[model samples]
Target: MTRYQPRHTADVRDTGRRLLVRGGAAATVMGAATLGLPGAAQAALPMLRYGSRGSAVVTLQKKLRTLGYSVSTDGIFGPNVLRNVKAFQRRAKLGVDGIVGPNTWAALDRATSGGSEPDPQPEPSDPKPEPSDPKPEPKPTGSRPMLRPGSRGSHVTYLQRQLSSHGFWVGSIDGSYGHLTSQAVMCLQKTYGLGRDGVCGPNTWSAVGRISRPRAAYYSGNGIEIDLRRQVLRVVEGGRVKWAFNTSTGTSRTPTPRGTYRNFRRVNKMDYSPLGKLWRPVYFYRGYAIHGSTSIPGYPASHGCARVSNAAMDYIWARNLAPIGRSVRVY
Candidate 1:
């Protein structure tokens, strides 16, 4: 005769405890193994950017050095690390945002584990692939509607991509033609001698296809050059215009001083002066700076400081493109 009975509470508790201990031990082993391998550890790593510090930064620096980048594993994410990250991102064909997010970390893992070469300075034009033949221009189809602000669709996204590929910053390709898209279109129009209507019409599309990289007046240094007449800003690197952005300089009442000056000071947050609020100001002269502004019209509208879109200023900050002591040439 057998008496069927449920397991006692103590027995169940003991079995549960044993399982928990075994699971924790297995987890500990897995964690140790993951930390031993770079690629495996990347999934649990946090994003590293400027000003980040700790053991994670050390890991990033070590991985960067492994990929032949000259970065010190001092557990500090400084300007040098930011530059190396940008260079690596550019090399990996990823967004050159200088932030070691998940995508960047994955790219680093692939490059290091796959036995890729060192971080060689790629040609400026390597990222941008130009068509071999410029003769056969892209004809606009009838279905291509004229893009204006507030238009939302894939066509607007295509327009944004084209403008970005042409080196005009359109903020983001969100499939919506917003203010930034309109501003970029106006910049393209201004560059190609087209009418600055801020509308993407047939002529604008044609110019987008035919235009080449805009050249800066001062092509001998790494700095920022502002074309007052064109209302455009050129970021020059190694004597080439790496990027161009639409800017609004000082109005006629108070002109942006025309001279070559190094960025003597900088404020990463919104700065208040007697004139108005300036976002992330990079001061070149006594009171004038290249700052982000809420209102950056196509013409000279600022009181004195050069005004660019807030997003553009952020891009400049992220890349350290206009660091302290960097030259700023205004003409």
Candidate 2:
């Protein structure tokens, strides 16, 4: 067995919420776009910027306080308020001008209150021939329910729905937990920095609650998307993700370059200097390939390459998935 140290972090943002739990606990967790529109009384809230003050400022301050910001909710626009606003702006990837105008207000409203997640991407084609599973009814749980291989129920169906909604192949929605569903759940667990236990529990359930759909590079084309954050390598054919693989990408020191690239060379098998051996290596970036590893951890561990399991790499080559001239996108 490939041995690598496991590192798990409780990345639940102060504002990020849990999945399934409702009531007052719901306030402690998140729902999709719950913050999208400001509160009912926020329609008249003024555009706030540096030096602006009054009830509108109070509204912004209260929103910030509710979002776990350290700023006071005193309704006075001050240095503290500006700092929190700018930080929120940066975290949300909105304009960093610190001005709470229409755009900023809209973004802040859409911001995740706790445990921030990526915005949902456009839904891809259904991976299975059958109808997609219906959404599961939510309920509070005493403890995080763990769904592993051999598990079966409506929850399994719900889990399958979550995976397919995010473009991962869960095989089918028959509510039977099997290898394919296990693989899909593993990919999802890996993507969100959760433990690669092939078990869907609270953290995974919460992650599934907030689906981050991956997009193709251009408006339309067959391509490969290597998402570092999601740790997924998506095979995009005709501008939609047809398949996905859990990939272990580069570390912080040797980060994978973010851009569009193409396969330039390949090797059936090679014994690299420190990497030992790479299988079905298809090179795109310098020395970096969508290759195979006996030990593809859930997190970033490679020097700079995108790595899948040996079998997955074989599947890619067998199908001529990453032929020369095909786009490989890392974003």
Candidate 3:
């Protein structure tokens, strides 16, 4: 079972709005270009950048934030905002294709005022398929949702979209948690040394936002991502954030937990031992660990121990921590 988390204020609402309005989909607001010409060009908003600092980004961010998207109006298009966008898109049932196109814009317009959800079912305009002389190339394998930030829909879709923004492709944003999404999620878990289950919950989303920040590094085929606000751990690897699980810290957990902790050890596969004080085997470190549990339910679940899934334990066992001496820090 994979855990997930949300990264925004609870006051936020899921008002599915299209961010883009295409040429014939809605009324147009045209403008003229330079050279003393009228009606020369049409104006459209560009794709929002992550952690962007500007008026446009701020306006968009505030709007999204108000609508229950976990994005900040910090004038920067950060990971949080991207997650928000993906959430909005998903709820609207628009293509989880991640791009902020006309369909997205139209939805956004309705979302701002707490409007009702539009019908996202595919239209049957039935354009005739053009015959191609050359055969089309085979599509890529693996199902990663093309979801972007601010899409509206189910929590699962929301989680998948957030993961995609943080460099983990979870397959087509079809609102289904299939194998491809799970594989991408596992990649994130392996990188961060978390249990490699493919479920997206509060813990996983928190890790996704944190890893997007600076200072997250890849170590000996594994990595860790820390969320300052939520105080959790996210495993990553091979340029993708793998899995996210909970952890515990020292009595004076504040400053120490703030910094990143690199992999120091990996405990491998073991037989189920009821005699042990754990539901699963333990992976020990200097004084901490990434292990399994039968009682971990929420944040601060371990005694500075990084609790992970049994699968994650097995993965680390097979793949030793080659970067055992890397530094972990907090911001």
Candidate 4:
């Protein structure tokens, strides 16, 4: 319903309205529940206050974000969140105690759902010449032409359609490779550790084809597993893979640990020592974490830290997929 480049995200509800793009459009992946209002995409919304974390906090952050508030939806409600809540309450004329009670949640729901802002109109282009040259340049003949910015057609439509189906929002499916589509493509590229060139090429297509969700396993609760054999990270919840993303693990010399661990801490943006700039890091061990990266190759490559695309990491944060104390089986 809205489009934005990641404020560095620029974030949902539940009978959980899991917005998985299927077919040529976004098919709402719904779970068991009842007839309800919007916000089903998020699992649920609980009362959030200082020191709160998890999906509820994520939902609150997203609602605040959609209303033009600058807050990181990292699922951690620290002082920044508290301050934002107070600011919002002041604006809404509610009690300004910084506690998100029923009133705050209701106002957030109303604000985000009140109406739709029209998509920005494209800038006027230079006047074009008459259609004397009908044939024009020859189209690139391939199973899937390498799509870049300024490209358009049914093929573009197909690409856009497929992207949206995989939960990557490319704005609209109008068969136009505009900025929104480009951002989506960039995200997709980063998800699998491909070059962040925003071009839908062979590698991107392969990753797209390999897109899948995780399946139930021995674990009975929420956790994350990085399959070395498959080079993918599975987001396991309640014995089922809610979502999956392509990943590039550590190289042989600096291999990842093959054991069960728990996410001990989280940093919304980490640049301490050797970690570099981890957009949203969920630490499963000391130093080693599943973090967003700019250079994620199909093959193993990190300095022992399991790597995911920045886009994938952003989704993880936006959805609170891997909260602290969650199981992380890396085998």
Model 1: colliding residue pairs: none
Cα RMSD (angstroms) for every candidate in the order listed: 15.0, 22.8, 20.6, 18.1
Candidate 1 C-alpha error for residue 280, in Å? 0.2
Q: How many pairs of residues in model 4 come into backbone collision? A: 13
Expressed as tens digits, the lDDT of each residue in 1-331 for candidate 4 is 3986433210233213444333222234243223243564332446778999998898888776555344667999997678667766765677899888777787776666653321111101214321222233333334667888889777777676566555454544555686556666665666667886678888877766675423544477778888875566777777766555656778888888888999998888754637466657888988888997766655688777877666557557755788999999998
Model 3: per-residue lDDT, tens digit, 82-106? 6556766877878765555566666
Highest lDDT against the true fold, candidate: 1
Write the number of the candidate with greater lDDT, choosing between 2 and 3. 2
Best by TM-score: 1
Residue by residue across 219-269, what tens digits does model 2's lDDT show?
277889898987888888887776677788899997878898999988876
TM-score of every model versus the real structure: 0.60, 0.49, 0.30, 0.47
lDDT of 4 at 108: 73
* Cα-lDDT of candidate 3: 0.44
Model 2 lDDT, residue 161, Cα: 67
Q: Which regions of candidate 4 are displaced past 4 Å?
A: 1-154, 163-220
User: Model 2 — which ten-residue stretch has the worst lDDT?
Assistant: 114-123
TM-score ranking from best to worst?
Answer: 1, 2, 4, 3
lDDT by residue (85-153, candidate 1, tens digit) is: 886786678899999999888887766665453332322355656323323324565555788987876
Superposed model 2: Cα runs more than 4 Å off: 1-144, 149-166, 170-183, 189-198, 206-213, 217-219, 269-274
